[model samples]
Every structure is written in C-alpha cells, then in structure tokens.
Target: MGEKRLNERVLSPEEFVSGYQYITEYLKAGLPLCDVLKRALKYFEDQFVDSYCTIMLLNSKGTEFVNGAAYSLPDDMLEKFMHIRLFDGLGTCGTAAVRGELMVSPNVHNDRTWRSFANVVKPYGLKSCWSVPVFKPGTSDIVAIFAVYSKYSRYPTQRELDTLSAYNELLGLIVSNYKIDDSGEIEQLDLNEDDNLNSKTLYVESIKTGLKNGEIYPYYQPVLKSDGQELHGVEALARWEHPEKGLVPPIDFVDHAEEYDFIDWLDEVICRRACEDMKKLMDDTGKTFTLSVNISAVHIRKQNFAQRIEDILDETGFPADCLAIEITETSLIDNLTEVAVTFQQLKNLGVKIAIDDFGTTYSSLNYLKYLPVDTIKLDKTFIHDVDKSPIDRRICKTIIQLGSDLELDVVAEGVECDQHLSIIQDFGCNIYQGYYFSKPLTLEGWKNYLEQF
Candidate 1:
C-alpha cells in the first residue's frame, strides 16, 4: 500500500518549541482547564492566521465527542457541534476521533467524510479543517481532540503538524484533570453515562435482532479421538454476524445474552442449527457423530431444563442419544440436588451429560461421584503444561484414571501440538480438542472437514 499522504505545511523549530512551552507552563501552573483551553485555542489561532480552534473530548462511552472549548467559532456553529458521534465518514473531528488518527480535509466541500456535516462548517466560511485525536499517555484511549479550521482550503504544514505531540500532552493533562482526583482515584465522569447506557442498550437489542434474523448461529468445533484421526463429535459454539462490527467473537456478547435471559432461547437456536447441520451431513455422507451444546448454569436452573432439551430434540428431529448437554462444574456446585434431578431427567431421555471445565471450580470431586455424567472434560489448564510439568501430568493422569474407573469418557481440552497430544494420549484421555486438529469452523467449513471421512 502507498504511504498515506497528509496535508501538512512546515513550521519553524522555534514556533513548535514555543507552543509546547506555552501549554506546558499552563499545565504546570494548575490553571483551570477551561481557561487553559481558551488561551490555548487563541494561541494556536494566532500562530495560524485566519483559523478557528476547537476542542472536543470523548464522553464516558467513548463513541462520541463533546465540545470542550472553542475560539473564534460562531455561537450557532458551536451549539450544532456540541456533540459529534464517532463513525465512518463523520466529518474531520468525528472521523479522527473514531479512527484514532490525524484527519486533514483540505476542502470540506470536496471530502466525502465531510459530506454529512459540511453545511455546518461551510456557513462559517471554514473551507479546511485539520483534526488530531488526543489519547491518554501510554494508552490508546482517546480522551479529546484538538482541531484547527481555516478560511482557505489547505492542510497543515509538516512542521506545524510536528506540534501534535505537544497538543496531545496538553490535552491529556487537561482531560485527566476532568477524571482523576488529587489522590489519583479515577472518578466517574457522568457527562455521558446515559449515552453509554443507550449505546449498550442498542447493542444488546441488536444482538436480539440478530438472533431473530438468524444472523446469530452456531459454529462447530470438532472434538476428535485421542490420536486426532477421527471426528468423535462437534461442539456447537455461538457466533454473531453483526452488520456493522462484522463477525463478533462469542466472548463479546455471550455473557450479555446469559445476563438478559436470552441464552435459553440462544441455546435452542444452537441446538436446532446443530441438528440441521448434523442431519445434512448424515444425508450427504451417511456418517453420524455426536453433537454437544453448552448449557449455562442459568439454563440448568430453569424448571423446564430437561423438558426444554426434549422439546428441542422432538421439534428439530435431532437424535436424542447423539446430543450431549455440557453443564459446567460450577453449575453443579450451586444447586446440587436440583442439578442432580435435571441431569437424571436428561439421562432418562438418553441425552448424554458431560461436566464442562472440570477442575477449575471446586476441588471437591464429590459431585462427580453422584452426577450421572457420561464424560468428564478436563480443563485446559491440565493440558497447557502437561508435557513439561510433572504436576500437570500427574493431575491429568489421575483425572483420566478416575474417569476410567467410573466408566466415563474423559476429554482433554487445549491439545495444541504433538507434545499435548502425546502427553494426553499417554494419560489415557478418551478424546481431545484444540488447534492440533482444527479450530472451530462455520457450517460450510465443517462440511468440508467432514468430507474427508
């Protein structure tokens, strides 16, 4: 790719140092930031004649900019520019704030990014705008923006742009004063709390809409035989195809759904999709494999937990025995009797139960002795260092032995390379999963994977 060209004019070394020293003195003197902003804007405008200066800072949510201080800008324009949302093609300041880069529009009338907000600036006789995002020192978090608007269509000189670091330093010093106390405790900036809440609310609602629209679905990761030669089963993992954000990883929104009573419905969606994919694979290749779907503790606590599984199976025509419901060790620890009942009811319906993420929760394996689980999934920690650490190897060997004694299959997770595979197989784990075989795949990707056998 070609180097990104910025419209910058050169400034003298004395000019750059003078600007830096001026801002530094104000910050060191502990002047009120509002006063500092006014003085700073005037100083910048004096250096670059026929220019107006404005400052904007990110609200608590970090999605938009709030007007901080301005010099030589019209009162009418100031009111309209009070809040500028960060988005693609959202004018000079907004784009710079969102993209975390320097934005220079030599001609607002000609720039596509200025299309939406051109009229706001054109009326003020501003033809060019240069914006630089101010980030917190040693962090990517943008705290504010410092911009200059000029009457002529031109970009800042290279020498003038060199002072951006000084601008950022001053902006950070001022913005930090807005949040951090004398004791250095970060105080809540309630200025945009409602905006942040609204943004999150919309995001959560979008997930709900995505689920309804079938934009959210399952991606299958194969659980393989210990030697990594055959597909034993595939675990259904949820993924969201967000319109704006692209493919969002499950970690971003999985807990959001679980928190909002949406996971139960999402669980059904995953089950149905898994069933459909499995049925298609069977018809295409006549090969049948087990399917596992994770069940959250909240879902297990539901009164209709077992019945919900049965209903999904009957509704989707998925084989009952071919489906395994993975409940975590933490779930069983919470409501022992209730979970026992839930598992027993599921077992009666021929749905296999596996303890997911074993060894991470309680050290007590008392629940394992009573729960009717067909498999015990050893946590990733056991395999992460099993090859080099004797303790990890011994712990894994003991877990596999316990599973063997109880007539239960033991699955070792995070089996990444030859060492993990060799160590895990030696420990007698019945199945293993991780990058050694393959990472999770979409339905089409999994079909290609299953085509081998």
Candidate 2:
C-alpha cells in the first residue's frame, strides 16, 4: 500500500481487536519474546507495506537501549542501534526515551531533529519515522519505544497513528506482564543488573564520577621475549584506584562501565594514555616499542572507528604500527562484518591486531583464517596447566603451530612459573606474559623494570 491509501483507510475495529487477541494468545502460548515481536511486526507490516518496524527497550538498569525487535533493517543499521544511551536529542527512539514523548520526523532529510543523525539513516533510504515512548501502565517512566519507518518521506497519517496506538497497547502489555517459556518456566525479561544489584548501582555511579575525576587509569604489564628476557611490549590494563576502596581490580568496575555503555570512554582514555607512554618510550630510549591496548566491541562496530583511532594517533604522533589493539574472542560474535572492516582499515594504517583470550569464544576458526589479525594471545586457561596436563600442553602446541602456519605471532598468556614458561617455549611460543615476567605495574615501576632490561 502506498502512503495515500495508508492515510485514507482506517483499520477496521474487528481487525485491530483480532491482531491484539492473536498477540495475547501468542503470549499465553509461551512463545519467545523475539518470536512475539516478530509476529507483531508481521501483523503491522501486512497492513503497511514497504515500511519497517522496531522495538527498543531500556536495559534493566536504565543505562542503555537494546533492540527488543527489529524488522526489515540491515545489519549495519541494526548494529548502529545495538546500544543507545538515553540522552537528549540522540535519535528518534533515543530522544523519545529521553523525553518520554512521541517523536515524528516526517522528512528525515530535512528534519531538524535528524540533523545530527542523517548519516546513519540516509543510506538505508529511511525517509520518515514516527516513534512513541512505551510507558509502564501506572507510571510516566518509559519502558520501551515503539517506532515505525517509511521508505518515502511523509508524515504518518491518522490511520497509521491508530495502528500505532494499537501496537503500542499490545507492546505495553507484553512489557509489563510476566513471561513464561515453552517449558513452563518463568523467564526474566531483563538481564542488566550486576551481582550485587543495588550496591552495583551505587558502584556504577561512583565509576562515572571516578572517570571524570581522573581516578581510572592505565597500568602497564610487561610482556617479554622468552628467548632473551628482553622487553617486547606492555599491555595497557585499566586500573581503578578508588580512594576509599584502595586498588580496585578490573573485574570490579569494567563490567559496570560496559553495562553503563560508557566503556568506550574508558577505552579511549586508555588508548590516549598508552600512546602517551609510547611517545615517552620513544623520547627516553630513542627506541620504538609496541604498546598494546584492549578495545571493546563498542569501538569496533562504529563505521568511523578507524578514523577515530587515526585522530588519536595523529594527536599523539604514535606510529600506527607501534600500537596493537587487543580484542577478546567473545567480541567476534555479534559484529563480525563491521569489525573486519575496521580491522582492515587499522591494518592499512599499520596497526597490529591481536585476539586476546583467544580460544574462549564459541567462534569458528574461519575468523582466524579470514579476519585481519596479526597475533593471537592464547587464553590463560590453556597455558595455566600446560606443564602438568598433557591435554593443555597439546592444545598450546597446536595453537602455536596454527599461528605459525598463519604467519601470526603467538603470545602464551598466564606464564607464571618456570614450568609454564618452559612448556610454552618448548611448544614454539617465544612471546609470553603473566607474573613469571611481571605483574601489571604503575608507570614508575614499569620504567624501573625497563631499566633492568
């Protein structure tokens, strides 16, 4: 149906009631949340052709918006919407979440609200959008956003508004009601809380303050060449030196920053610090050395991710080849295509890419073959018991051989004693990290350690 027909025809009362009743039946039948959303989208799309639909809901902690359901959107667009912080004038749904109001952009190309976001939606031919904030029944607080999009630029008609109201009603019911699985067990709808719940809430707030106050910083851990006891590089690890809590481990706050969706800021801060240290090493010793920094998937998914890194490198005058980006295997799952593109850009810029905690993800080895990676940092699990367990030793040996065949450098992580170090070296892995070499240390400590080498 074209926009003209969509504007003229009001949905029949019987058809609207049946659509809602079908959703209620689907819920009662214990369908999965995504299934119900898919059904709802199909129901709406059958009436409004050539249009797309989306459902965005706040995470339990109210820190970010995640895709509850999306129909007819491409991977790049979906990836762009994966994590949105509820802030003013972010985008259609983000702004709706921030204000708890309906947002209508009849012409995204010319709409003032879409001025900052045209680049994200223009490529998809998304010309118009109308979104309503989904609120809990008894409160003004938004629980989710119900949005509809048109391929052609035009305002939503009165008939479309009525259909939207119908969809919103059904969606609100789904959001507020308890959900059950096919196996007759209750399923928790939201998974945004930390282990300590409210304490985590307070802790996360403290992390925000800590970030602004310069309390979160990068701690350098030395990585050594197993053959010569020479300094190879240092991995930049984030350290939270909380005033009252003493030295807080990464485990305590990394997740909180990620959960709050500002972990990118932490990543950026550490990258800048590592680059500064890289410049320092170059200036003091007149020697260029690698400075490895871990980058979150949050940074990799951006279309302009490489440009952002380039800007940093330009500011610090750090050679791109001297910087290595460490990403965990788990980050490879969701945004593989986007990450590959970003990696290629970085590689072209002379940055080395390393996969950290290598074998931990349920990912295919094909990524190892096709992705632009320079090194593999074997997960500590394989190295931990290589001296005692034959299985562990064999695994480490195979990984080393695989890296060799691929012409990729291999770093065996968690080499704490002669036993672990000896086994890894015997397996043909010459690069190693962990306490056997040195623990993560402050800048001064790292400088002293470097002096010894």
Highest lDDT against the true fold, candidate: 1
- In model 1, the runs with Cα more than 4 Å from the true position are 1-192
TM-scores, all candidates, are 0.57, 0.61
Residue 208 lDDT in candidate 2: 55
lDDT tens per residue, model 2, 1-453 = 111121123344456556766655555566676666767777777767568887766665554665567767653565565455566344677777776677888787787666767777888888988887876543445667777888888777676675665455346656655443322233545433312333443455566556656678889998889453787788999998888888988888887666555577778878887798768777997866789999888757755778878988999888888899998888788878888888999999999999998877668486686689889999999888888889888888988999999899999889888888877788788998898778999988888888877
Backbone clashes, candidate 1: 9
Taken over the whole model, the C-alpha lDDT of each candidate is: 0.75, 0.73
Show where candidate 2 strays beyond 4 Å. 1-198, 362-364
Supply the global lDDT for candidate 1.
0.75
Q: Candidate 1 versus the native: TM-score? A: 0.57
Clashing pairs in 1: 8-156, 8-157, 8-158, 9-156, 9-157, 9-158, 10-157, 10-159, 11-159
lDDT of 2: 0.73
After superposing all C-alphas onto the true structure, candidate 2 shows an RMSD in angstroms of 15.4
